[model samples]
Target: MIGKHLFSVEAKHEFVRLPHFGPFLTATAAGQAVDSLLARFDGLSIRMHVLASNQPDGVEAKEQECAYQLECACSEKSPLSVVEPLARAGDLPCAEEALRIANDHGVKACEIGYLKVDEGFLLLHVHMVTADLQKAMTATRWRRRELLGRPEKGEVVIMTTPIPMLANS
Candidate 1:
């Protein structure tokens, strides 16, 4: 079994209400006010629900170009900041074959979020959570290194320890 640490990170940002239109709603004073609530958030949030082991099957040749997908294993909960580095990785297909492949690889759902400060869009918050905690931590460390443009000493906090699994009879 995998560890439950589920690494995560978060930062704060200055926010301004932006206009939005939903299927059953339009931009209005009340809507803008509601949008302003997002200002309370420093950055957008995202979660990885399914990690596909392989692409969906039965895709026609004509659809193959569109099939070059990756972020399907992920879910985005808010609009991304223009300056944010991480983008939608794509979503996992609902096809049975895809699900089977994901299962074979022991894939599990995960989540990510961002935070930026009000000044010049400096990212103030960023967070990621996954059953694959090592991969997530590596990515976070890489991001920090990129921001600093050099190698830096750092450590990821392990929130939970993994339980030892007994051998199967």
Candidate 2:
């Protein structure tokens, strides 16, 4: 919940095709950015879509509609953008190696999630979705520790406070 409303990214296989971390995060981040954009441009009527109009890609101009949409992904939302991450930057991408890269980068310390609003900063959800549901459970423990730093006994409610860094900086 980073903005005035819940805007969403309608991902095609192109974005969520897995193993490719930067693309996945960038695509997902784009959705999150759009949601935030909606909040910023609340009064205007925005016609939004995934920006796919060409076989190689057709959503070029629409990517620039917002400030946070990341220049790279928006510029080449078509076939050319496939090789790299346009917005969100992280450890190098592997062919469907998002989980491995994430773990290596520091799973216990940080995992990515969709951005949510927190204080004056944005939020993120970095859980890896797997058919092995048990694996997803770690997000709980990791989030608790990273956010609250090990609550003492009897501690129940936890709140998150994000420290803002420029997007993709």
Output the worst ten-in-a-row residue range by lDDT, candidate 2: 78-87
Local accuracy of candidate 1 as per-residue lDDT tens digits, 56-140: 3432431332121111111133222212222222332234533343344333212222223243221112234344434544555
Count of steric clashes across candidates, in order: 22, 13
Candidate 2: residue 121 lDDT (0-100) = 22
Write model 2 residue lDDT over 1-169, tens digit each, in one string: 1222222253222122211111212445655555443443223233333332223232233333333233322322211111111123343333344444445544322343322223332223233433221232344444445546433321111112122222232
lDDT of each: 0.28, 0.30
Report the alpha-carbon TM-score of model 1 versus the true structure: 0.19
